[model samples]
Target: MSDFLVSRRFYAFAVAVLLLGAAWTIQSRVPLSDAAGGQLTSPREGFPAPEFTLEDFQGAPLASSSLRGQVVVINVWTSWCGPCRAEMPALERVYIAEKSRGLVVLGVNSTIQDNETDARGLARELGITFPLLLDRDGAVTSRYRVRALPTTFIVDRRGIIRSVMIGGPLAEAALRSKINALLAEP
Candidate 1:
């Protein structure tokens, strides 16, 4: 009887541990909301964009907070990234076509993994005219949680992140469609 009781108690403890682990896993995966049931500010879609200021190649300081009323496209990339090179023209085209409509495409170089010379050269070569912000210390990259070379975050005019593109030689048509949809929004 003692042996059976001990075995039953051990099994119960094991089950409880497993259940707790499962519960924690599920909880951690779910997005957290504020006390008022509003979406918490984060770097993800439907959340307020994590703000940062960086110097453009011309050394002009541009802050994300300053772009509140404009639809902003934050592209995190390294100069050596092939997809970055490929998408540069498309991004530039979108910027030129939509700038008057309050579209701002910010090319944020992960300068921690790259250099100023190479980034500038690539920009010149690709004829990219949008502001190329340098993340010299990787602070902006860390804030945005950019794990990939060419991550793009599309923030709506109200400063909330509306979409996130992880990796791509993102097609011009698709990019334009997403931006146009957001631009159409109030």
Candidate 2:
């Protein structure tokens, strides 16, 4: 009787593991959306990137929808993050080289966790030319589910998220390769 009980327990555990795995697989295949539009927006790859409109560092409104049909690199950062500071120049170089090829690099500063003055100062120090979109109220940051300071989302021309790099001083060479491949895609 004890042996049978032990075998039954083992079987139950195995079934639970299998069920969890199946659930994960299904969730990965189906992107979830939080909005009422059911647009499949998610921070995961193969999902539509979340739409946002924020004031640029210059106080002009910039909408993600306005960048349709262009490859976008959205880098969520804060001025105090060391990795964010380290990757700014690489991001700038990539933006400059690829903007003509339809690349738009948006440095999304989580201003609630940072300040505009420091963000501007860093941009000047690093010669960053990409638009710095400020998330003053933290809405954009929360929408992106940014758990780290330097998360980056690579969205293709169709606005589908192609890659998500979390916690990075992402290498310029790697960044270039990813962008080139996405830009090459139809």
What is the C-alpha local distance difference test score of each model? 0.90, 0.92
Model 1 TM-score relative to the real fold: 0.79
Q: What is the RMSD, in Å, between candidate 2 and the native fold over all Cα?
A: 6.4
Pairs of colliding residues, candidate 1: none
Name model 2 segments beyond 4 Å from true. Answer: 1-38
TM-score of 2: 0.79
- TM-scores for all predictions: 0.79, 0.79
Model 2: how far is 84 from its true place, Å? 0.4
Root-mean-square deviation (CA) per prediction: 6.9, 6.4
What candidate 1 gets wrong by more than 4 Å, as runs, is: 1-39
* Candidate 2 local lDDT, 5-99, one digit each (tens): 58978789889999999999988774446432457788888888999999998899999999999999999999899999999999998998889
